[model samples]
Target: SGAAPRVDPRLLAEGIEASRRAAGAQASRLSPTAAPRQVPNEPVHQDGLRGLVERYWDNPLQLERVLIGQVQPGPLSPTEQAQLGRLLVEKHLSADRGRTLSRIGDEQRNYPNLARALGRSFQAGALTDGHLGYLLGPQGLGTSSRRGFEYTGIATLVAASGSPALQSTTATRSWELGAKQTERHAAVDFHTAAMRATGGSTEATQVLLQQAGPALIAAVDAVADLSRRAPVHPYTNRFSTALGTLLTGLSHLPSSQATNPVGARIVGHLSEQHLTAPALRKGFFDYLRSARTSRSWRGLGPASGNAFTQQELLTRFKDPAIRNHIVTEQYYRMSQALEELLPGQASWATFAVWASRQAGSAIRGEPLAGASGTNANGVRAISHGNTLGASEIAPLFGAFAQTLRSNPDASFQEVWRAAGAPNKPLLREAFQNYFEAYQLRRSGGGADAIAERVLVANTLVAQHEQTALQADIDSAMRVQGVSMWSLELDIPGRVLDLNEDLTGQFPPELRYLRNPRARQLEQQFGGWGDSRMESLFNLFRLNQRDAALHGDWVV
Candidate 1:
C-alpha cells in the first residue's frame, strides 16, 4: 500500500477547499459594462489567443502595421502606451513631436478600450524595431505567452514547402523526390524562357526606372510636403521671444523701469519665463522671410499665440498679474478682441484703436514720439506720421501699409478686419493710410506714382520669395532621394498649402505674389521698387536706416 499522506498535506488540502468555498460564496456577478466573458470551448489555457489568430488572419490589413514593425504586439502597459504614442508623433509630425505624443497619451487614458485605442496609433508607422527589441528583450515574446501569428503564419508557409522532412525507403520520401523532380524541371524551363525575353538586366532596369519616374516623384513630393518644415513649437516660440527681447533690450538702453536693480531682476525673471523667446523671435524673422512672398500665413500657422482661439490663452494666463505684466498679455487682449468679433458683431474699428494704442505705447516717450502724432482726435494718429521723415512703423508693417494704400476705397474698419486685427502690420497700414493724404502733403510729391512704385516693388519681393521657396522645396526633396513627379501625384497640393500655413500671419498683399499673373505684370512693367512715391520712398529710407542703426546700436 502507498504510504499515508503527511499531516501537512492534509491540512493544505483542507485550507484550499475552504478558500474555494469562501470565494464561491463571495464572488460578484459580472457588471453590464464588462466585455463579453465567454470562456473558450477548447481546454487549451493559451487564452483568447486562438480567436485572435483567426480574427487577424481574416483581417490581413490589421496585420500590416505589426509586420512593418509598428504597434508592438501584446497589451501595452502605461509606459508602453507612452512609448508607442511618442513614436507615432515623431514619425508623423515634424513639430515638437515629443510634446504632441505626451498630449496624446494623456488624452487617451480616458478611452474605454485601451487596446483598440492604442491600435489606432498603428495606422501610421507607430512601432520601430528598436522599440520592439527593448520591449521583448532577446526573445520576441512578451509577458504573455501569446505570440503574434503574423510571424507564425509566414514561418509556417516557408517551412512547409521547403525541408528535408523525409528519409529514403519511406513513403514520404517518394513524394519528396517527386516534388523535387517537378521543381527542378520547372526551374530549367523558366531559365530557358528568360533567355529569350528582352535585352539585358541593365536595359530592363532602365525601362523600369523610366516607367516609375512619375509615380516616384509624386510619392516623394507627398512625403516632402509632409516633411517640409518642422513646426516652431511653443518652446521655439518662447525661445525666439526671449532672444528678440534680449536683442531688442540690448540694442536700445533698458527702459527706465529696466535701469534699476529691481528692473534688472525683473528682466531676468522675464527671461526665465519666456523659454521659447529665441525660437519665437526666429520664427518672427522667418515669417518675414516667408511672408515676403504672396503666400497666406494661414498655411504657416500662428507663431506664439493661438489664432482666434482663447483656449491656449485661458489655459496659460489665468493669473491677472502675470497677464497684465507680460507682452503676451497684450496678445491675449488682442485675441480676446477678435473672439468678440467672431460672433458676427464687427469690432474691427475697436481692435484698430486698441492695436494703434499699443504700438503708440511701445514707442511712447522714446525716439518714436514724433511718429505718434494724432489727427484732430487723439484716437486716430497721422497715417504718414514719420518723424524727421522717418516711419516709426516696424519693417513688418510695410506690407500692410502697402495693402491699405493699394485698396484706398477699403475702410479702416474693413481693412482691419481683413488683416486679422491685433496684427501689427494690418493696423500700421490702416493707420498709415488713414493719414495717407497727410503723408502726401508732407512728402510734397505725386501720391499715385509713389503708390504704384511701392506696390510694384512689394509685388516683386513677394514673387521672388515664393519662387525661392518652391525651388528650395524641390531641392530638398531631391536631396532626400524623392523625385518631383512622385510628389506631384502623391501630394501635389500639399507644398503650397504647407508653405502658406507657415506664413499665415503674413498680410494677403504679400502672399501669392508669385502666381503667373504677378510674374506677367512684373515683366510688363518695372520692378516693385519703381512704384514707390517720394514720401513713401523717404519713409522707406528712414526705416532702412533705423533698422541698420537698430542692428548696430546693440550693447
Candidate 2:
C-alpha cells in the first residue's frame, strides 16, 4: 500500500477540543445546568444529521458519495455499535415505511452491507420487540384489509367510499406529501413580494385569485400527465381526475377574473379589481327589500339544501359576515350594496344593529301554558333529585290523551289496562296527591283553579281509556269463545248494545236488532245472515221473538 498521508495527532486533538469547548460554552449560556432528569433515550435528531450533511455535501444528490468519502465501513465503537443494529432494523421495517426512505442517501452516512446488517441484527435482538415484532412477524402478515388487505377490491371500495368526508380528506392528504419535498417558507417570501406590489385590498384579492387560478389549473394538468405516465396508481389517478374537474370549474367563475381601473392618476394606488361588485349590487338590494317587508327573513338567504359543501368557500374568506352575506345569503344582501355604487348613492350608509328585549317572546322556544306537555308538578319534581317514576303513568296518560283527541266517548278502563295497569295502592296514592292539589286550588284561585279543573279532566280521560280497553277485551273474547254474554261492543267508541234478553234493553234505533229473523240477516255474509253469525244471532234473537209471541195464560 502507498504510504498513508501523515496526520499530526496533536492537531486533530486540538480541532476536536476546540469544537467541544465551543459547544460547552454555548450550552452554558443557553441552559441552566440542573440535576439530570430521566428522559426517553432516542437517537440524535435527523434534523441535526441532515444539517451536518448539507454543510459538508452541499448537493442532495451527492449524499451517498459524501457519506462514503467521510466515513469508512467498519465496526462501530461500543456505543455506536449498540445503536447501529436498531438503525438497520428501523430503516428496513419502521411502521411508517417512508421514514426509512427519508433517511436514505448522503445524509445517512453510507456504510457497507456487512456493517448495516450487523446494526440491524443488533436492533432486532436488543429492542423491546413488542411493537417491532408486530410489524415484522407472521402475526401481521394476514391478508385482511384491516390486517393486510387479503379481501377483494370490491369489499375495500364499499368500505372506503361509504363516508364522503373520508374520501375528501384522503385526497387532500396529497398536500402533506408534496410539502415534504419543498421549502414552504421560501415560497411565502415570494408571495409577500407580490402582495407589496398590489397596494390595495381589492387589488390583492384579484392578484391572489389570478395566480391561484392558473396555479391550480397547472396542478390539475400535471396530475393528468401523471395519470398517463403511471396507469397502475389508480387511487392517485382518481384523485387527480377529480381535482382537475374542480379546478377547471373554478377557473370559469366570475371571481377568478381580474380588472384594471379606466383612469389612473395616483403613483402607488392599486388597480380596481372588485370581483364581488356586480353580484353585490343585486344581493344587497334583495336583502334590504326583504328585511323591510317580510315578517320572517325566510327567502332572503340561499336555500340550505344545495348540493355543494360550504366549508371550502367559508375558509376562503376571513370575515364570517362576508361568508354569510356574500356566499351564503344569495343575492339578497349584495344587490342593495351595488345599487348604491353610483355617484349620488355614494352618500348611502348601512350599519348592523344588535339589541335585546326584556321579554323576548320573539324567540320560539319559550314555554307557553298548555303548550308544554309537561305539567308544573312534573317540572318541580324533576329539579329535586327525583326520578320521574312515570313509566307506569305515562303510557296510561298517552292512551287517555290519544282517545280524547280522537274519540270523546271512549271509557277510561280500557286505556288504563293497555297502559300497563298499576295496582290499586298506586292508584290510591296518585288520587291522594290529586285530592291534595284540588284542595289547594279551592283555597287559591284563578289559574290554580283552572289547573285543578284539568286534574279532574285528566281523571275522566284516564277512566274513559280504561272503559275502551275492557270493551276491546270483551269483543276479542267473544270472537275466541271465552265470553258467553251476547252484547255488541264498540271498542274505540266505548259503547255497548244489547243483542238479547241477557244484554238488557236495546235502544229505539237498535230495535231492529230485536227481530230474530232480522238478526240472522244482519249476522250472515254481507248482511247479518251468515251461518256462524246466525247461530250467535239465534241465541239472542230467538229469545226476544219467543217473549214477544207468547201471550199470558196461553190466551
Candidate 3:
C-alpha cells in the first residue's frame, strides 16, 4: 500500500467521455425533440436533471452504471438522486410504461437497485398491476434455464413489494403465459431437438436425458413454488396441465441407463411434492367435477347436429371411450412414477383397482342408453349414440387382470409390458370397441343380431391388427440377411412397403358406413392415433415387448 493505487487520469477521462457518449445516445432515443446536451463540470442544472430522468426512464442499464460510479467517480447529489428516483418511480406507475421495467429486471446486471426502486414505488401505491404484470410476463422470465431462476427472484421481489391483489394478478398472468411457453413450446422444441440428435439410438437418447434432466427439474420446481405462493390463482390449472404435459413428454423418452437416475430424480420430486399427495388427487377430481358442468367442456370440438342441452352434454362426458382415454393417461403417469420410485414394491392388483375406481367415478353420472339426439350435421341421431358399452373397456381390464393373475407380485412396469404397454393402442381399441358396440346397438337387432354384429366387428379389428403386424414382420424378414449399415439404410423403403400394405384396408365404403358410429370412428381413430410420434413410440415398445416375449430379435 506504498502509494495506495494511483488513479490513471487518462483512464478516468476516457471513462467519463464514454459515459457521456452512452448517455447522449440514450437521451436522443428517449427524447428525440430535446436538444443534445453535454455533461458539465459544474453543478447539475434543471435541463440536465430532465435529460437524466428521460435516460433513466428509457434505459435502466446506463442509469445503473452512472449511479454505481462505474461511468464516473462521483455520485450524483442527494437532491438530484431523489429527483431521478421519483421520476423513475412515476414512470413505473404509469399505464403506458410498456415492458421497460421487465427488460431491466431480466437484464439482472442492475437488479438490486431496480428492485429497490420498484419496492418503493409499490409501497407508495405508485406501481400498477400493469407494471407488475410486465415485470413478471413470459418475456421477463424467458425460456432459458438461467431465466427460470431469474424469474423466481423477480417474482419474489415483486410479490414482496405489493399487496396480494397486485401480486396475485401478476402471478396469474405470468403463469398463464409462462406455462405455455416453457411447458408446451419450449418442451416440444427440446424433445424434437433431442430426438434428432439421438437419431432414435438408445445411447444417444440417454446422454440427452442426463443433460436435460436438471433443467427439467428446475422448471417444475419453479412452477410448484410459484403455485404455492399464489394458491388461489386461476393459472393454477394451467400449471397442473403443464405438469401433466411435461410428464407425458418425459415418459415418451426411451428407458436407458442414464434415464434411470434422471427418471428417479423426477419421480422422487413429483412424489414428494405432488404425484403421491392426496391434495393432488383431490384437486384433480375437483377439476373433473367442475369440468363436467362447464360450458366449454360441454361444447368441446364442433357442435353436433343433435344439438345437446347442457345436461345432455354433461351426460355424454361419461362415455366409456372418453373416460378410458382420460383414465389411461393418468394411469400412465402414475405407473411411470411408481416404477421409478418404488420399483417392484407396488403390485399390479392395487393399481388395477385404483384405475378402475377412478374410471368409474369419472364416468358415474349416466348410462349410455339415455343419450338420444341428432347428429352435429343436423341429421336425426342419438345424443350418446356413439357411446361405448360398459363392457367396451373390458378387454383392457382383462389384459391387466391376466397380467396380475400370472404374476401376482408384478410391478407396474411388468404389468404394463404384459398388457402391450397400451398407450395409443389403448385409446385406439377403446374407440374401436365403442364404434362396434354403437353400430350393433343401433342395428335394430335383438340378442342374436347383436351377437352376429359383435362377431363381424371383432373379425375386422383382428384382421386389421394382424395385417399391420404381418406387414412389419415381412419388412424385417426381407432385410434380415442385410448388414446393420444396409439394414439401417433400407428401413425407409420397408416403411413405405408397410404403408402400401395398410392402404385401402379400411375402404371408403366401410369408413363411410351410414352408421354414425362408423363415421365417428373413421374420423377419430381412422389414422390409428392423434399423434404420429405417439404411434411410432407405441409401435417400437410393442415390437420390443414381442421380441422379449418370443426370445427373438427386433429388426
RMSD of each: 27.4, 29.6, 21.5
Model 1 residue 3 CA deviation (Å) reads 49
Residue 409's lDDT within candidate 3 is 57
Query: What's the true lDDT of residue 437 in model 3?
Result: 40
Q: List the residue pairs that clash in candidate 3.
A: 304-376, 305-375, 305-376, 305-378, 306-374, 306-375, 372-383, 373-381, 373-382, 373-383
For residue 329, model 2's alpha carbon misses the true position, in angstroms, by: 6.2
lDDT of 3 by residue, 1-555 (tens): 022233453454344345444444222221212332434322324344444544456566766654554544334433334444555644543423333443454344345554445544444454565554544444333424444334433443343332333344444444444435535545432232222222222333344444454454455555444434434433233233334333333344443333333333322333223432232333323332322222212222222212222333234344343444334333333333322322222222112223233223223332212122212321101112112211233344345445554665555555556646655453444334423343444454443333322223333333333343343323323423211111121121222111111232322223234544434433443454433222322222122111121210112
Question: Which candidate should be chosen as best, given TM-score against the real structure?
Answer: 3
Could you tell me the lDDT of residue 161 within candidate 3?
A: 35
1 or 3: which has the higher lDDT? Answer: 3
- Order the candidates by TM-score, highest first: 3, 1, 2
C-alpha lDDT score of every prediction, in listed order? 0.27, 0.27, 0.36
* Candidate 3 Cα errors over 4 Å, as ranges: 1-209, 212-230, 234-252, 257-555
Q: How close is candidate 2 to the true structure, as a TM-score?
A: 0.17
lDDT of 1 by residue, 1-555 (tens): 222223342343233233323434223332223322222122232122222222332223433332232322323223323333334323323232122222322232232232232333332224333432322222222222222121121111211111111000111111222223334333222111111111112232123223333332232222223222324454323112222322222222222211122112222222223433343233222322222232222212232222322233223433322222232222223323322322111122222222223333322322222233322222112111211001122222333344445764655565545544544443344343333432343456453433333344333332332233344324323333121111111111222111111222322332233434334554554222422222222222222111121111101
Q: What would the per-residue lDDT of candidate 2 be over residues 35-116, giving only the tens digit for each residue?
A: 2222222333222222333232223333333223233211222333333334433433433332222233112223333233
At residue 89, give the lDDT of candidate 2.
32
lDDT of 3: 0.36
Backbone clash count for every predicted candidate, in the order shown: 59, 48, 10
Worst 10 residues of 2 by lDDT: 346-355
